[model samples]
Target: MIMRPGHQQLLLPVNPFFLWASLIVALLLNMVPLGRAAWLPDLLALAIVFWSVHQPARIGIGAAFVFGLLMDVHQTALLGQHALSYTTLGFFAIMVHRRLLWYPLVSQALQVLPLFAISHVIEVAIRLVGGGIFPGWQFLIAPVIEATLWPLASLLLLAPQRRAPEPDANRPL
Candidate 1:
């Protein structure tokens, strides 16, 4: 479909398999031992939020909860910690999904910042309740990183679904 200037083309329907595959890759990336850089960004959370915003029907709260459970298991943290956080994130994403669709990519990222922060807050609250010590202000860095990476993540994930340009059909003979 041809998109007029200043207007964005609607995204094509995404494959369910591709959606799950991207989540799996994000999970693996999250699992990579980055040592000190472990706080870099939560790729898994980013993927969940991305899909939750763009394709809520396919990746809803239940999916976020499942992925969060998997993350908790992989990290050996409190079993339900990630689950609650992700579910909350998904809720916020769904709430703002339509409004988000109208903004440019950078604006969308900016808009989602609060959702990312809320997810982190949920995780921190869980940790605190479990008698864990404060992880320090540096712990807040992940949300900022995740928000910053939003555009890149959207681009990469949507590349396969983007339509190719049409040939010129109105050219003079």
Candidate 2:
């Protein structure tokens, strides 16, 4: 692929420990005691999608499913509700990871908007089928928020990898 003039420097190989740690942090964020607000962005979903796109080999559907199950257990919701949502999200993210990386951050977020929306739709459909009440239009706000968060997530999560592995006075990268 042709590089853009301001294309970012080559990133370091992601540390396995940091990769899992970030996922755990995202899970903990979701586990916070805030009341169930339909508009709250799914931080875990954002993290999963980010990693799936940037580090596809490291984080995949299996990790998404495991985290989703953990969320299901934590929130006491339908057993597979989050698992299915995340698995779908991760799958889509992985599918588009290559193409997605070529776009500007803004465009990338726009592209990912649908993935987040679809994941939410799956969750809502499952909830309704499982006899849960509609969460109202506020639920729609989540995907938008998650999409908006894409650039920020990219910045934060990619920070560690962006640094030079070994900064030397003679070499600037």
Candidate 3:
């Protein structure tokens, strides 16, 4: 479909099942035992931010909170940390959803940097308040990585929603 002057590409209607399935896959990715690279990008957070921006009605704060809680349980971290982070992230994403939709994927990633950073900051604050030792500057790397991966995540998650190419009406028969 031809996008308007101020708009990004038009996406086909997304299937809710596919949406949730993507989130589940992100959760699974987060759960993988990466050992030293355990501090890698939060795939679930990236997915949440992507969906919240692209399809706010389908994925909102409640979904983020639930997924955060699941991460808490799975990681055995303090309860509600991820929930708070994700809820805040969702709120900001929804706040800018319309504006964000106008940008190309790479630009969207640039715009989303602060939202990802804010979520990481919230998590850090919670850990600090909970008396967890500072995990060092390296702990800050994940948000940057997450932001860097935003475009790829957007492409991956939106692939199914992209409309298939139309047949050329002017083709010579």
Evaluated with TM-score, which candidate comes out highest? 2
- Identify the superior model by lDDT, candidate 1 or candidate 3: 1
- Relative to the unseen true structure, what is the C-alpha lDDT of residue 95 in candidate 2, on a scale of 0 to 100? 100
Ranking by lDDT: 2, 1, 3
For model 3, what is the C-alpha lDDT against the true structure?
Answer: 0.85
Deviation from native of the Cα of residue 93 in model 1, angstroms? 0.3
lDDT for each residue of candidate 3 in 1-173, tens digit (9 for 90 to 100): 65745665567899899999999999999998776342578889999998998889989999999999999888877899999999999999999999887777778888998888888888878988999767677767888889899978877878877755553667422
Task: Give per-residue CA lDDT, model 2, range 3-32, as digits (tens).
Answer: 854676788988999999999999999999
Provide TM-scores for the models: 0.89, 0.95, 0.88
* Candidate 1: tens digits of C-alpha lDDT, residues 36-61: 34257788889999999889988999
In terms of lDDT, the best-performing candidate is 2
In candidate 3, position 156 carries an lDDT of: 81
User: What lDDT score goes with residue 53 in model 3?
Assistant: 88
Backbone-clash count (model 2): 0
Cα deviation of 1, candidate 2, in Å: 7.2
